[model samples]
Target: MATEKSGTVGKALGLLTLLGDYPEGATAGQIADAVGYPFSTAYRLLNTLVETGFAGYDRREKRYRLGLRIYQLGQKVAHHRGFEGAAVPILQRLTDLTGESSILAVLDDDRFLTVHKVDGPQFRTTTDPGDRGPLHTSALGKVLLACTDPATREHLLETIELTPRTEHSITDRAELRRQIDQVRRRGWAGQQEENDIGMAAVAVPVLSASDRLVAAVALAAPIFRADQEALQAHLPDLRRAAATLALELPLRA
Candidate 1:
């Protein structure tokens, strides 16, 4: 039999899940109606969530939304599921198709952070879990930048140092912006020896059910084995894998 405390906890969690579905946030009355809880009980639970930082209440909007704390917890959950778990098979399949290394990356502040990687028989990439790279020099980063909001993208481009990783790296702000614009139009991004000499890569955005960009899946290879054209040729396969991964992985936002 469920105790009173356990029942309350269950209801609170159900309410939280419902709140997640509405990223724009909802009111206490809406949450109560959705969860079938009493108005008073729902209000108490929302206050608890806000105090704990699990949810935030906007004073001006008078709506409750998932807080930064929830985002932090989600990131930890994603990392736990990434290595040798949900993302492995997809990465392995990409590597198999391209005969190159494949990577899964998420936006980490102003940079792209690799979460998982699978190497093909022909070559292995240096990227690994916790490794971060600039958004202007790598295919995965470019896709992420392209999918971000215009204001946030501009802030990142202006603040983050665009150090030249190689002669091919785009250090000019206008040029990089144009490149990201192209990425948005093409639905994919590619780099030829930009992040590292002799390394070429192509990436596709992994979007959630709500069409929000959550992560990216990329194929990387040695320039000698696969140039930009070769990477572009494998985009169809990469996009398919990315689509599957988007459904499998939890939504970051």
Candidate 2:
């Protein structure tokens, strides 16, 4: 009985998660197929969600989507998380010192998700908060990969699709492993036009008080303005900011 109840709860949560991913909304049949639940079951669950204001259904489109309640809850969680409070000032300081855009990112499953950014007055990057990037190319991604446990890193490297975003992107798994090893040895990571043609970036890990990797702090600039050497030169300041951020983060064990 307990197992049956747990499975039902899991399925309901899975449906909600799937709905959250489809911002444009999806039909009951589509949701049922996606979650591998019976059509009737999916419809019932979606109706229940709608009744609770956790989801909305469009009669004209015959589609279901996450509702205002989810957005409100997400905003509340984001405020309580204090990620912006802890990171914005550091990013601003780093950007001021380096004369480049500074970004804070966290590993989100197989991708790196930028959470905060501060652009230098002279230039700005295309990356923005909520943007997701591949793990093998970006400096922030490399720093995150380097800081993960060996087993987790190996699993991610093997499982993640190594799509080349640009000519400099490392599509070769062995080469990516080598680069991650270098990042581990150097305590930071860098990329020169790897993810984009005219951009360069360097990143250092932000570790918790217990020395657990929590996130990465990165600085990006136009390749003409800052080469790898120039980016590396800013490491001391970046590391200092990262240290301060680590202290500020409320990481859980």
Candidate 3:
């Protein structure tokens, strides 16, 4: 059912996501029924989205489809597939530089969404491109939380359960905050056997030219293959890759 939480903005974007399902496009009435909204409400919101260029109306077919603006913005985020072509090689190079798996993640709701991943020649991880990971346990998640604005960070910390994936995971919110604080200060984050036993990771935020947090990249490997010191040693390479990706992501300011 359509929700009231985000009011019009949320519903409108929800419509866009729903629209993605119909590549041939959908009529306003079809969209309204799918979302459980009144025809008039759906039509108005769809028109609004069309006017803003986030959606398009097919006059001949009397249908709505995703617009060019959506494609332009989608080309900057990995999961959108438009930017994956550019992101894949960068991740591959990072994996080569560190001799570990490289991960590219973006915020998905309150979790870290794995959008792109490159496995090292020596080892492979169970996590894949569409995996969603805990925000409190993985290095990618920490960098995302640490770099976000204070309000969002606090909201996530307060609301997200500190679910321990392994014995090393920080289940305590206070301790997690301290770790996040350290990550904020150091401009990077690390996790040891937190998300997975015998696995470790280190990450840095991919910031836009304007210094806005666009995404995060991480190098992950098993502890036997790369211990904490080994992981931290790759920080320089990770930062360099992130810096380079910042220019490539092309996020909206």
Candidate 4:
């Protein structure tokens, strides 16, 4: 029994290494081949990972992928302070200035999680806090993706499988990478009728004092009301708000 347990641990470690090497993830057979392990052993380990929340499976493709648990563990270590407590007031100010709803979001696990949000008046439009959207489909998600380190970004893209939420959603990996580069160059990202038809959004990344990206701030409104001039006009305030949040975010040691 002891020998069997030791062998299992070794196999699990080998599986993790394979995943780390290939961020785009691997099939059961591919993982087995990568680790040079027996097919049955690799299959068992993959099944155990899915059962324990250490990996995810794509129902459509029938492939194994890394789960949110790895990201959750990283978040625990990366962000020790509560994000909402420090960022809510800043988001409120953005709403007060722009009259559009503001979202304070962090890249949670494998998805963007809204930690705080400030709603605008009845005339304004909004989405809910705690709403989860595809990274390739939302402005806030794009900014977060664009601002992070390149190696990590590539790793994330590998782990991510883009699902077309709408016709405007970026389904092509190369196109998404090109747009992300544009966001990095311009210091902001925008989505027009991408995730939701008739809705539009602009987002900028909040960087901590240590220069690590902490979250993204976004202003969302009806697409008809958010023309190019209006979006460009709001950019300064948006950038300022992100910078303000960055200043307030605790420097994780």
Best-performing candidate as measured by TM-score: 3
Candidate 2 local lDDT, 1-253, one digit each (tens): 9998898778878989999788788999999999989999999889988887678787878889886556446645674575465579878888877788998887766788777788878787877666778999999999999997677788997888999999889989999989999999989999998999999999999998766888899988888888877989999999998998888865521
TM-score of 3: 0.72
**Which regions of candidate 3 deviate over 4 angstroms?**
1-40, 43-84
Once model 1 is optimally superposed onto the true structure by TM-score, how far is the C-alpha of residue 140 displaced, in angstroms? 0.5
lDDT of model number 2: 0.84
Better of 2 and 3 by TM-score: 3
Candidate 1 lDDT by residue in tens digits, 132-170: 789899999999998876776788877878899999899
Question: Can you list the residue pairs that collide in candidate 3?
Answer: none
RMSD of each: 7.1, 11.1, 9.2, 9.5
Structure candidate 4, residue pairs in collision = 24-158
Give the Å error, residue 209, model 3: 1.8
Give the TM-score (vs. native) of candidate 2: 0.69
lDDT of each: 0.85, 0.84, 0.85, 0.77
List TM-score per model, in order: 0.70, 0.69, 0.72, 0.65
- The residue pairs that clash in candidate 1, if any, are none
Per-residue alpha-carbon lDDT of candidate 4 for residues 25-123, written as tens digits (9 for 90 to 100): 678899888888889989999989888767877655667877656645644544445444567788888888998888877775457866577776644
lDDT of 3 by residue, 158-179 (tens): 9998878898999998999999
lDDT of 4: 0.77
